[model samples]
Target: MSVTGAITSGDASLLPGKRDEDWRWTDLRGLIRQIPAASPQGAAWAWESPLAQAGGEVVDVVNGRGRSDLDVPAGGEALVAWRFLSTDGAGAHNAELWVSVGEGGKLTLVESYEGRGAGYLANTTVNIRLAKGAKVERIVFADDHAEGVSVVDASVELAPEAAYAQTVLTHGARRQRIETRVAHPGAGAELRLDGAYLLEGQHNADLTTVVEHLGVDGTTSQLTKGVVRDQSRGVFQGRIVVAEGADRTDARMGHHALILSDRAEIDAKPELLIFADDVQCAHGNTIGALDEDALFYAQQRGMPAEVARALLTHAFVGEVIDRIEHETVREAAAGWAGQRLEL
Candidate 1:
């Protein structure tokens, strides 16, 4: 399969604007300018993922184009499609995966991104709907090359008493962003978002989330943590909005980042917009270097300096991993983090 297309003029317009309130801090134009024209490349490389045969709905987007080899679950259905067009110096390639969970159904959807060409622009969108009392666990892994620009847009709607959980893991990329918007339109909905990013070199990764409490007695929680080394940069912006009619809404948002080098950077913003007087909402964000006191304590106890640093870094990210309800996934994620932090 060859994944290449024309270069659309004014494609930058399709990309998010910096003037937009949500992307004010990020330079979208500058980033898009760095991407070269897309070209079709031969599909000579392949990846084997445990998620490939996990049995629900599987969608693969390789190098800004969609793949047609997909298998739906026995009792599930999927809508798969692709969109490609050119604008100017840039282009837009979107692979959409939509899944509908039947009543009291249990499903797992996994979307993975892997790019081949360097300096190519890629954008993807995923939409999911869970029926009443249904349960869905979605996992997104962005293991793109170190020289590609990628963005993922995910929107989910939860039915009454439905349960939804998502885990996002990203490695280093030239520039990467993942945005998730979740709405609890039905009463007593439960939603949780957990994410982790491992960035090094000059790579950049951002995870932004907006969760809305629109129904009475709904609950939502989000925990995002990241580790940036060298001159890499990471950003986490999360907002929880509670409607006036959502009297019994409960929501919490937390983000933390660990800066490993003097040149590394992290920008964190956690906001809560509440309109219901009876709702309980809170948000917290923290960005700083490793804890010197704890480091000194470990060093005094005869631990090597490098070993102490790794221990502290692990503890910082462990809080986010602990929130993963699935034991197997949580252990695998933790192991991946441990190997990445090896010093």
Candidate 2:
């Protein structure tokens, strides 16, 4: 049912492409003419892992192999650093991981995707479950090889009274996509999903998410912002579906981006489907260049052109970075973006 599934199983027939509505922009089948050979096992992570200095239980999946599950006991609290690393440029591989948080448990996840080498393919799938009254915050930073292709799919399930929040940041690759789907069982549960990307060259990045509210009194909030230069591309697809009888569901989704070059592209689709008459749902999308007046204002104040541009861009994307709850993780995210924007 996934590109990773087809690649690992050698079933090209199952690959997703332009024919599939969700994968049209990504078009994995078209980009990959032939699946590469299987990747070798036991590749080491040699880069400075994100949030590594913060210190926590480290779980690494190298070359698609490592511990595949994590659990937080009832009323427990945990801080974990989960990493996915790809070091081979010759072939394709995949990994699947599961995380569970018991009732009243709290979990903070600092995740990283460390990919190296060129012309490789990598896929990762994660499933998360939260019991009633549980709380979870996941922050994912993707630093992949610019010449490689990568995809990440995550599914989240939340029981009544549970809360889940997530933010994803990526620099993009030859072709990279991150998809998140959430199953929301209302009864006062809450969800927040956010993403930010800085893409350049001919690279591509896609952030897609779907949240389905099956019961009453659920709330969901989503926002995504991206910046692209050269001929690179950025895509954001967000959909929220509230089934019949799912009354009092409040959901809002927004996608905004800035294109710094005439050749760059940004595609966004934000949708809301409400079967309940009393639900409140809305969606918005905006794609354009930076604020010219603001840029000029900063320059007039004595800042150089590049400095002014970087300052404005940083403030624009900093909204999402500021949402990261962990202090160390938030600073790390800002530093990553600042370095990319040359701030």
Point to the candidate with the largest lDDT: 2
Q: lDDT tens string, model 2, 274-319?
A: 8899898998899988899998898899999889888888898999
Evaluated against the true structure, the overall lDDT of model 2 is 0.90
TM-score of model 2 (CA atoms): 0.97
Worst 10 residues of 2 by lDDT: 42-51
lDDT of 1: 0.70
TM-score of each: 0.84, 0.97
Write model 1 residue lDDT over 123-151, tens digit each, in one string: 66667778888777766667666776777
**Highest-scoring model, TM-score:** 2
List the candidate 1 regions with Cα displacement exceeding 4 Å: 1-10, 34-36, 39-44, 48-59, 67-92
TM-score of 1: 0.84
